[model samples]
Target: MDALWEGFQEAVRLIVRGDAGLREVAWRTIVVSGSATLLAMAAGVPTGYGLARGRFPGRTLVLSAVNTGMGMPPVVVGLIVWLFLVRSGPLGDLELIYTKRAMVVAQFLIAVPLVIGFTAAAVQALPAELPDLLAALGAGRLRTLWLLAREAQLGILAAVMAGFGGVISEVGASMTVGGNIQGDTRVLTTAIVTETSRGENANAMALGIVLLVMAFAVNLLLTAVQQRRRR
Candidate 1:
């Protein structure tokens, strides 16, 4: 309990003093996780929409794969990415291992399925004739998709939050693929792990507190926007 109190004090002190290292870690966390979420949103939204609307051969197989991915262990995701990007492995000549890029890739893979699943569910819950109605109103493909998206914006926002949350909070994959290199690949979650392992309980707890606050802030902003849109 004392340790936790000290940690909170330390965290406040760090924040009030504008600690450089903490700022960097926080920024990097946003950049990496934000990039992953954006990429996932771009790819997953369309893929999910297609899944919900189009019927083709092997569609079930693809959905099953996405469903499985949504629940797969983060460590396993890291290992799979590590193998493909490791030295002597195929496509590893780019030397991306243990870098922020690698972490982003791993995180993107982790978040995409959640985005896809949520997006498909959201779109599926919409009226079946939405597309037809839009077309009847002289809406082209792009316009129709746009309108449908507006109607389903709430669910899409939920997908965004889920994807962002999943990647931002995961340490296993980030540590595995990123090597947790200080000033390079260390994120909030990994930083907390490192501090705790080194017996820096106050520092670890401070980082944990920062992480929770960051996550909550982001979600709060998203929720505000979501609610505003509904009105």
Candidate 2:
């Protein structure tokens, strides 16, 4: 109890003092996770729409893969990415391992599946005839997608939340691919882990608090937008 109280106080002090290291970690976390989530949404939304509306060979298999990916272990994804980016591995010539970009790639992989799965489910949940109805009214494919997306905006927003939440809180892939290097790829999650491992419980707790607050702030903003659209 005393430890928890102390940690909470420390967190408050850290925030009040405008700690540069804390700010750096927090900002990097947002950059990596936010970029990954945005990219995932951009690709996943269209892929999901196609899966929901188009009849094609192996569509079931692809959907199944996306579903499987949603539940895939973050460490496993990190390992796969590391293998590809590591020296002597295929594509190793790019030399991207142990960098912020590598972390983003790993995080992107983690977020993409969630985005795709949620998006597919959202698009699928709409009335099956919605697409045809729009087509009959002479709407082009892009316009029809826009309308369906608007109609299913709630689910799409949820997808964004899920994708962002998944990657922002994850530590394994970030550490593995980013090397948790100071002033480079270090983020809140990895920093918290490092602090904890060093027995700096107060510092660890402070970082954790910062991470939670950051996640909450971003989600709150997204939620406001979502609810506004609902209105």
Candidate 3:
């Protein structure tokens, strides 16, 4: 209990004193995770819509793959990404290994399936005739998609929250691909790991507090948006 209290105090001090390292790690975390979430949404939303609305063959198989991906281990995803970006790998020419971009890619892969699965479920839950009704009313394909998305906005927002949550809390993928380099690829999760490994328990706890706060802040903002939309 005493140690925990001291760690909390250290965390407060770190925040109150505007610790540079803490700020850097927090900002990097947001940027990398935020970018990845956005990219995943962009790709996943359409893929999900197609899966939900289209009647193509192998659709079931594809959805099963996405469901599997949602449960896939983060470390495995990191290893796969690392393999692709490593020297002598097919994509090695881009030299993305051990960088923030690499971390974003890994995190993006991690978030995309969750977004897709949630989005597909959301779209599927809508009135079965919604798409047909829109088409009968002469709505273009893009416009129909837009209307359906608006109708399913709540589920879509939930998808966004899930994606953000998954990527923000992940450590193995970020550490493996980002290398947790100081002021470079270091993020809150990886930073906490690094601090704990170095036996800086108080510092590790402080970073953990910062991470929790950051995650809460972002989720709070999203929740606000979600609730407002509901109203």
Candidate 4:
């Protein structure tokens, strides 16, 4: 306990002093995680809505696949992404291997299902009268879905927060797809892992602190927003 406290204090001091390497890692984390979250929101929001409202023969199977993906191991995802981006791989021609874009793609994959599944849950939670109400008002399918989304805005926001939380802390896929290269793809989570393994305990602890603070801030903001929406 004493050692942990001392480590925490040291880490806070390093962060306060604006340690350059830690700052770089923090910035990269934000850039990669934010980009992935935004992309997931853009794509997942509508896709989830469609899944919730649209009927098809294989809809249940598709939903089941998404739910299963939500449990997929980070290392497995990293392996698949690494294979696809490796030289001689099908997508290797794009030269996206070991790039920030590759990390973004991996995190996007991680975030999408959370967004979709949670959004679907939110839509499903709506009153059954919702659809009938919209129909009585002559609302089309698109508009009705918009209404449903609005009613459950808080839930959807929660999904976004949850997804961001996952991606920001993810290391395996980011490290694999990003190569954890200094001054390029290095992010806070991967940096923590690297620094710790290299016996840079202070740096690892500092990066860990930053990651924790980011996670807390994200969840706090999500809670605040949801509460505000409720009122």
Score each candidate by Cα lDDT: 0.93, 0.91, 0.93, 0.86
RMSD of each: 0.9, 1.0, 1.0, 1.5
lDDT of 4 by residue, 1-231 (tens): 554566688788877898887777788888999999999999888888788877999999999998987777777788898899888888999899899999999999999998998888788788878889998999998898788888989889988997898799889999888998989999988888998899877667767877999889878988998888889
Any runs in candidate 4 off by more than 4 Å, and if so which?
A: 140-142
Ranked by TM-score, the better of candidates 1 and 3 is: 1
Model 3, residue 90: C-alpha shift (Å): 1.8
TM-score sort, best first: 1, 2, 3, 4
What TM-score quantifies how close candidate 3 is to the native fold? 0.97
**Which lDDT tens digits does candidate 1 get at residues 45-102?**
9998899888999999999999999998888999999999988778589799999999
On residues 1-231, what C-alpha lDDT tens digit does candidate 2 reach at each position? 766777889999999999999888898999999999999999888888788777999999999999999998899999999999998889699989998889999999999989888888999999999989999999998898899999888888888999999999999999988999999999999999999999999999888888888999999999999999999
Model 4 earns a TM-score of 0.94
Per-residue error (Å), model 2, residue 18 = 0.5
Residue 51 alpha-carbon offset, candidate 1, angstroms:
0.8
What lDDT score is found at residue 148 in candidate 1? Answer: 89
Give me the runs in candidate 1 sitting further than 4 Å from their true place. Answer: none
TM-score of 2: 0.97
